[model samples]
Target: MTDTATTAASAVADATNLVPSTKAVRLPGAGKLLLAQIRYQVRLLISSGRAIAVGAGLPVILLVASKGKDTRPDVAGYAVFGLTITAWSTYGVRLVAAREDGVLKRWRATPLPRWCYFLGRILATALVAVLAGAVTVAAALVFYGSHFGDGPDTQLTVTAALAIVAVLLVGAFAWAATATALTSAIPTVEAAFPTLIFIYFPVIIVSGVLFTNLSEPHWLSTLATYLPAQPLIDAVTHAVRHTSGAPFLPVRDVIVLACWAAGGLLGAIVLFRWEPHRSTQRRAARIQQ
Candidate 1:
């Protein structure tokens, strides 16, 4: 009896030791999350032909329209700049609309890290923007005889890197802030672009896309420089022109973009709603009906 009892106790101890420890599962790292988000956004873009057409088509149309007989370098630069700006703006607006449509909201509710969600959208946008920018540059070079300086490969590389970074920052912030502010007011994905246009058109005009130069008052130019598109335009123009000087580091453009991004992030945090307005409205109408 004593031996049997001892055996049973040992068996129980062995069983307890055999049971797996309750180690907490670790969440993905920031890098992994970012990659996942990028993949997801890319997949979404591929799936939606309409989105791709709009995103890619507008740039192509502008390029075709701006392509002139002379093929001047300045013309090429401006054309690329305009196309890139449009791509960035379009992507930003679409991103917000998709998020407000509940895709991002659903992902946010999951166990996935928030950084992954945000980074994914950003990465996807960056990829599209870079590709679009490259195509725009190539088209300008081929059709307009546009050319960049043969400065050591290093300079070209650095300039390109800076340009992409600036675009991503500006684009992300514009999309986030515009989306949040409009969503707060309209609370529907359908209304996102129309609401954003009120802000977008003014920036486009002040950025001198239409004018030969920012011939506005000094204060207007200064203020416009701080707006999203102008800073990006200034950065692209300086880089393309290879204007080496104290004021042309592209840092000012980057700072303005950072401020926009920060402001948008804050607004999104404060006002983003997960529930669809249509659904809510439908339920209310049903209750009344």
Candidate 2:
């Protein structure tokens, strides 16, 4: 019994002396992940001509379309509008599709933080949106003779910059929410486009993209201003119009945009699914088998 006790004590001492080996790991921070995501997204955009065409070609086309027309100043507004729509329709849809395909799920399962992943996507999307907007503005200036009489003043510039950031943040949140709702109900990626179109078209129409002023009732105009696309449109319009001592400051527009951003973010946080349907199905099948 003493020998057995000595043996156990020796084993315990040996076990205590044996330290568990740890693997050296390096995890990316939110900023690093954002940069990485930006690089990846830029590469993807470069590879696909869609981004380039939208950034470079579409502005030229719009310029040509608006030449010798009644709606010359409207061209700049339309260009910005198109950029916003493209961001929401194309990039937003792709982001959701990637998530639905389990790319996001796999990435999340890694040691890499989820906030890092989201930051990366947001960084990437913002880069693309800004690049596209800049190119469009340049085209509007060169080809369409469009000019903002006062070039980016302290107040106007600050407002415009803040408005652009607001548009991106709110737009991203809105897309995330819409994507969650669609993916939860619909089964396929192809269906996402239609679902997005259904939600976006009405907003775009009511946004006064085609018509600068709404012919509808005062309440309708007030209601329309609160919609996602309209507030952004109003912000863009204010930037371009830049009439000194203008009657309206677009306070309502900014508030509406903020509300949409907050609501969508809340919805997305509550509803977004990390796993793909296929993985869920396969796991269930294996469990049953």
Candidate 3:
């Protein structure tokens, strides 16, 4: 080749070198992406009428409904945070919807990390749950004149409240993780809704907080001991009663709930997939064609 040709070729190569990378150069961290997701989720939570009722309204109503009697804060906790679990379970459904709608698929094509996506959901849900819990607590204190423990035991009551809040917060993250795993396996949002109902309502009904005494020795009551919700409630209740000088250890209950949380998070990380299920349908249809 001539010297001119060589020079032209070299210029072309250098220009190509400067043509910018197609491999998606990632900046520092996924923190901004995760924060954006959390903000969007918070807006979604606040805008939904159902979410308002479930995340905030229900807690206050349940607290006021107790009507100045022998009020169990655990019952209030259940009403407030139980629906929080249900709401976060809907996070799983959102995953299904997003996948089916191609939102997750598009996101997967980006440089934003996977953990940030799910972490945003968990953090957002936890925030809403904590808000609901705060409302319930305020209603208990102001509306019903409820007390965690009698006078001269203020410090113990505060300790119990903190412990219960901590349990609920951890449980929220667990519910978010577990529900993500469950809904990810499901192909459609419609199916996911029913699955959530089947998973949530049965556990709520059988927790024995609604009907039977947890102290009862029946097999169903015994079975409740194995579930996460019941154990959390038990732990909080023990904390409350312990404030009144009762000797109680919530180790068994806290351990059970913590195990559930950890197992759920690990399961979600392993089992949840962002890929759309429609790929199989498309391939099958093409084969038929």
Best by lDDT: 3
User: Between which residue pairs do clashes occur in model 3?
Assistant: none
User: Least accurate stretch of 10 residues (summed lDDT) in model 3?
Assistant: 147-156
Q: Is candidate 1 or candidate 2 better by lDDT?
A: 2
Tens digits of per-residue lDDT, candidate 2, 1-289, equal 6999999989989896576558776655766666776688668766776765764466557666766675454543455555555555666566667777878788879876666665455445555665666666566667544443234331335555455545544554454444444455544578767877787667667667545564777886777777776776666666555556763336776677677656755655566566766677788999999
Clashing pairs in 2: none
Rank by TM-score (best first)? 3, 2, 1
- Candidate 3 lDDT over residue span 96-191, tens digit each: 888888887787788778888777876777666666666666656665354553343323366677776777777666677777777777887788
lDDT on C-alpha atoms for all candidate structures: 0.58, 0.61, 0.67
Residues 128-221 of candidate 1: C-alpha lDDT, one tens digit per residue = 5555555555555565453442233213335554664456446544544544444555665566667666666666677774444635788877
TM per candidate comes to 0.71, 0.73, 0.77
Return the clash pairs for model 1, or none.
Answer: 37-120, 38-120, 71-144
Off by over 4 Å in 3: 1-26, 31-36, 68-74, 80-84, 146-157, 213-217, 242-249
Which rank order by lDDT, best down to worst? Answer: 3, 2, 1
